[model samples]
Target: MTAATAPTGLGEAHTVYLDHLADADEYAATDLAIGLLDAGVPAERVLLDLVAPAQAEVGERWARNEWSVAQEHAATHISEQVVAAVSAHARPDPTNGRVVVACMDGEWHALPPRLVAEVLRLRGWQVTFLGASVPAAHLVSYLHRYDADAVALACALPMRLPYAHQMIEACRRSDVPVVVGGRGFGADGRWARRLGVAWAPDAPSAAELIADERALRRVPPGQLAHLADDEYASLVRRRSELIDGALAELRERVPAARAYTAAQLDATVSDLGHIVDFLAAAVYVDDASMFTEFVQWLVEILGSRGVPVGAIALPLEHFGAVLRDFPRAARALALGRAALPGVAR
Candidate 1:
């Protein structure tokens, strides 16, 4: 679509890029981005307004089961490539200071932060985009070696708040305030405030925060303050036992699971382990909703894989039986199980 003939400005660009992304056509996607630039669209507008909306829709398509796992990955990869292609044409920034961007450990969603990195660079910030699943120790170590004006942490899942908290406190201990984004911290970053750190809702806001000359001196949180009981710690110690028990029960109950190839079984086992870890984290934070929400999302993911949502109920029920004595664990498992289709609340 030509700039003048297009019905709207950035809106049309979003449509064009989305069409190519859905088809996993990298060159078309890159060409569309360049076309927008030729049409006089600002680089930041193309990155945030056009590409961001398209990427959000790609995620929604996956959530609605309109795209397979591989399709989602391919689309996201193409989007990443498109961002790089657009950045290649961006003018160099001379005034922006160094800033580090990273995702919380266990947060596999890197696209959002990567978008922020490029946007910040376009806005004249020297960005070090540390891709997905960065461990807190590694991040802390990196901070020691590099001097950054601010660090931006991305967390896309509520199940990751515990680790996000850890990373925030770690940064605080070193007197480096953190700027947090992504859905995991809630819409307004309520969790980030609870952990006593700065929260930026998006890339522009984050860049604005980083650019502000005012000092950011957030107080570090006390150690182990969020945890109440040894139950979470105990559960973590028994994590292997829990996953093994749940896997064995699923193998007996799910014929499809029993007939799976070794690789598939390994994936299933890993999924179960993640559930256990998230449950333990929920108990540690005294929130059942985190575990319950993860289950609801996991149900959709499994549904995309052709697995019945109700099959997940068995494992939740099994977890309830195994952790019956722990009040938080029991409630978390019950809420998760109840969230499944046809399960009682």
Candidate 2:
């Protein structure tokens, strides 16, 4: 199939796999994936075309409130199983140097990177699939110990870009060329460019990049001179204070919040913290759209779960007022507020 087209039967296969995910039927999901392999569908195609897109839909289902967190987790677990089954069914011996694949610190979305690792393996690279949230120091130590030819880092959330940058630099200090991918880098890998690392849009491109040492190491220097303004650093230092203050403001402004159940209150606190964290990351990257996009996503997620847009608006207004002295942060908050629905604005 060409780059723009899905294999003839794959679309139907994706639908069936998603149905299996929705049912939380691990055996059925695994059987379906392996059966595709048995039918002569390439293993990489099963992973990238079938399991990957199904997992993306699982996330969308949760975002739309059609699936609970429990359901999403169940589906994700099943997808992981299917990936493992596909990998085992088509195991290929490594014919190239070792590549260490891992998630950035604080990033728990390991499945995307796992697919990449398996793809690298299928293409004949020895891959050490270090699962989710591998810390920078530990990752650096492992790179040194194993003398990795290259490392592929994954970050599924844009909010973790700061940690991703740090981890990328740590690997560089050990003389390992780094290639990063995932939604965290933005769909175009713009954030990865901001950090001055090689970026792959998917597993196939990542495998190709890893094969060409010169291309992988030839990225331009990071364009983080704007960090000299110190807004990102200051925002991070005040993260806890910002979250607490936002929660206090929320409780005072929204009377019902004071009587929220423990679970509801925890969720509120988490959302507040995410706002500050996402804002900090945006500031770090000097991109207001990052914060704005996150606000839009947060609104959809919360709105689907019965939250009013005002619930999100109030926090944006609060953070804007509090960070008024920090130009970059204040500007980003303003853009985020503008991105809210008309009623909230």
Candidate 3:
């Protein structure tokens, strides 16, 4: 079939974009991104609609041993180029509020922060793109220099957790309200709230957040509520059906396999809950990174730990099940539990 004859929708188009991303077809991905941008797909939605899904697919392929690290790196490079191009055109309204979008020091993944900036800019808020790996001192200076209305940080790795928190604290010390997004902001989200800053799990929700009254006023105790309500509320509300049921079934299969501690299981459950939260944020706000990151992390971490993702109830399993009902996770988990004697409970 000719490319022009191919079907189109968020789903079909998304698959093509992902294939190009995984293949590191930089020219193709860039053109797809440009076409998406020309289609009036808001830059934020493009990230949510195109880039994030593309990243997720690349990640999934890597997890399944389908794509190599070089392939993943190539895909990321292509995505960065395209997303950065779109971000370059993000012009904010002159009289609107201002937001500073940055990546914390050592967090070079600029896609999420860039995505947030685009959405806010599309919403008529002035955005200053600080690019990637920004130092805290420089960000503070920029906040004062620009008299920024809000600060947004995008993080894409767990390795930069400490730096991300430090930057948020620094912003708060400067009396600058901040909003944080990215897939890696998982366990550290509460820290952002505790520092009296705003948090958006994704770009689109970050736009809605900038629109909220809370984004304008002093940060409140409930400011985090919007991060949950608008960003991740849906996934949190409905994840029990997937995670809880899966865990319960696993425990039933191997009653003696409960070598893993309750504390650990509880944390896993909590992480799954947060995954739901992130998914909700992505769904409602048009930010796919959260969902992508969650699944990606699960796959990578499990693989590193010699755990098969099919042994877990992660969303990938949910997605895989939808695609093939393969029970990849259940089988993997069962095998992993059998091999790792201490990880069962």
Candidate 4:
């Protein structure tokens, strides 16, 4: 491959990027990463949104067992391709120094670091995207070898927490500023803080966090807590619309008065479960289980009210952003409710 010729214009670039992402399930995401580079979207933006976000989404699905190992492997292989292509695009620039990104040992999720590398590189920083599962000693060695402006690590699971702490400790010993992030961190950001490291909730935020190292370094610990609070609040606000809408819909449907046979009860219970699942999903992302639990309890309460319909239905329905969004929640609801018997329907 002499390199797919770079897409000629912005419109052409849009076409190529979308086309690459279209049957993305069919090709390794790495191919799409190359396609983005070839389309000239800047190595950084592609890494931030397209490459890293795609990989994170895949990892999330895998955690939920929604994606098989093969699918995850395919995605990772494509990510390697993208990283290679982006590296080829890198050239020494007088403008900015280097930033190094790596995954802590026990942290096999390389895509986050890769995406962060691309983001820094795109912003004119030199970047070295070390692949997954790097040990603290190795990272410390690299940090000194490269004289990195900042060191970033992706810690995506609770199991990786010890390793992450070690890596951050290594950087701190060397007096190097470190940044950590991943969905695994979730809303409990205090751990990152307690570890005495800066935390980026997502790729874009990471880029911003590192854009001016001295300023970030200058901030006192007390000030940093304020920033963390703001970040968490923003995430809640971002999802508030969906959560509120779902609760509204759940308030509408009333349970029926007539008693039903076992078969009817089973079907009705299943349907109600579906409705709960659907509504739960509408309010949360990648959190179908929690949503299902909350909705099912709501359903049981509504069913006992002597109401003609499950009161939770209409309130949850109001959350309908689209029909497809409801399936995961519905599936979750069905699975949960299926276990219970003698619950008021």
Candidate 5:
């Protein structure tokens, strides 16, 4: 279906515009962004109020089974195009100083940081938008060479938090203040605080925090101190081992899985790997809730796709067996087991 240039008046056609996005029409989305500017709507408002909401709705659609992964990706691609159109129209004033925006390594979720980067640019910061999955070493070198006023990191998945922590620490060594954001930080940014860096709840707030003199100048804290009993490190080291054993056991116990097609089997293995990675991150950060929340979310996603939650839950029991001596992993596994539907404790 064709969508006209979005209502030039501020926010009048939000729902209609979102419908166009759901249809995977990039032209409709881009026309809306450009028309908003033509109507004298501020660039950032077009981005934050219009594009951002539609982008979020795309994710919600995928989460609810209304849209497949491909549809979600296509919608997001349209949103990115819209953001670019708006960004190109808004010239940077550079009065707010320099900032670096990057998505965490192993994190393919680039849209969040892309939004932040555009927001910073609109607010007159000399923002170097580093795109997605920038390696820690490259990021550190960039900070050292250009000497940014602050670094804003985006992480969407919980599994990326461990590597994000590494990036945060690397920035600290270069004396660049780091501001962490996105779902990976949780609702309150409790993990960001624990990792000993600043947190921004969203793009607008990230701009505000960087503009505020007091929050801007504070030096990033030194590396988070290590725990006395760091079972986390050991768990991380044996991650492949855990996934290998868990998959073998899952195939043995689940008769349906044994008869599955190659694609189905690959998806199952990938899901298990994600579980192991998330649990490792949880243990690395010494936080039980992250793993628990991830497990709950995974089960819900699986159930939505008509996959039995039991398939996901079974790994928890298996993980618990192998990681019996590891306190954090063991706790997370138990939480997963308890939260899974129809699973007996």
Candidate 6:
């Protein structure tokens, strides 16, 4: 069934599952998922319908600042446990070739891909799930050793797209067909197209794509001729300088920032770095919306935590001014600036 129509009672099961996650009751969460399996609910439904949606809500709660990092971590641990419990209960033998599932390097959000891996296993693929932040070299080496039919890479954040491209290329060099998924590829997998890789919107689609050898390898070449401009490269080389300058500017112009505690300063630095990294990724893909979308997300995240719009406005303007000679980077920053709430274009 499509996302709009979850199996009967799965909606209420989702609510109860979320409550269990919020309470950090791992035992209850596992029991609830296992209980579904016992009640004749498909294991795939247990994962995609029940566990997947609940994990997404966990992220939403964390993003809205309603859940502390510790609480979110606790909830995620329980979800992982539930996945393990479900996988063990529905141990399907492999009838297909091996598929290696992993998160892209520098991407620590492994749960989304973990769910995908389990679904592939349930569908009878000899799935080997390599969880979280796998470097490209090690991944290619492992693929060679394991004789993988295809490798499915996961990237959750857009900022990791550059690295994702690198990993995809590494897999190609090793003669392994690659299929990528997750938010890093964009909601419609447009960025994956930009990188010229096969992309699946979700687990089932990924399974179907992996099963279709001709279709998986027949994708068009990446449309990255924009990289010839060198803007993306220059932005990467100057990331450190850009973040340092932004932080210094913040300290000078925002008096409150000058007195920020250690944790606050680190977080500000991280936010500045994220802006630069996301802008660079936008430049890589030649999409202004990439940067603009990230700007909106950053604003909401910081705004929820009591940061003023000016705090974000200043950095966008600063990046724009600093990258004045780089047309694509400057233009992306300008579009990002226009996206800020209450900010004049």
Candidate whose TM-score is highest? 6
Give the best candidate by lDDT: 6
Tens digits of lDDT, candidate 6, 204-239:
999999999889999999999989978899999999
lDDT of 2 by residue, 1-345 (tens): 222332246778898788888889999888788777877889999999999999999999989999989999999999999988888999898899999999999999989999999999999999999999999999988987897999999999999999999999999999999999999999999999999999999999999999999999999999999999788888888999999999999899889999999999998899898999899999999999999999999889888888889998998999989999999999999989989888545
Poorest lDDT segment (10 consecutive residues) of candidate 4? 222-231
TM-score of each: 0.89, 0.96, 0.60, 0.53, 0.93, 0.97
Clashes of 5: 0
Sort order, TM-score high to low = 6, 2, 5, 1, 3, 4
**Candidate 4: where are CA atoms >4 Å away?**
1-42, 60-66, 86-94, 218-345
**Could you tell me the lDDT of residue 262 within candidate 1?**
93
Give candidate 6 regions above 4 Å deviation.
1-8
Ranking by lDDT: 6, 2, 5, 1, 3, 4
Report, for every candidate in turn, its global Cα lDDT versus the true structure: 0.82, 0.91, 0.63, 0.57, 0.83, 0.92
Q: Where does candidate 6 clash, by residue pair?
A: none
Candidate 3: tens digits of C-alpha lDDT, residues 1-345: 244744345566687777777666778777766666665666666767778777777776776767777887888888888777776665445567788888889887676576667667777887789899999999998877778777888877643544676797788788777678775655546534543556676667677776774663455553333343232333345467767765665566656436669876885676555544444434432334444555555656567656655455433344334323223223332332333323433
Scored against the true structure, residue 39 in model 2 reaches a CA lDDT of 70
Q: Tell me how far the alpha carbon of residue 194 in candidate 2 is from the true structure, in angstroms, after superposition.
A: 0.7
Task: Estimate candidate 5's alpha-carbon lDDT, on a 0 to 1 scale.
Answer: 0.83
For model 5, how does the per-residue alpha-carbon lDDT over 129-220 read when each residue is reduced to its tens digit?
99989999999999889978889999998788878988988987898777889999888988787777788898989988888757855635
Model 5 stretches with alpha carbons more than 4 Å out: 1-11, 217-226
Count clashes in each candidate, considering only residues at least 3 apart in sequence or on different chains.
0, 0, 8, 22, 0, 0
Model 6 TM-score on a 0 to 1 scale: 0.97
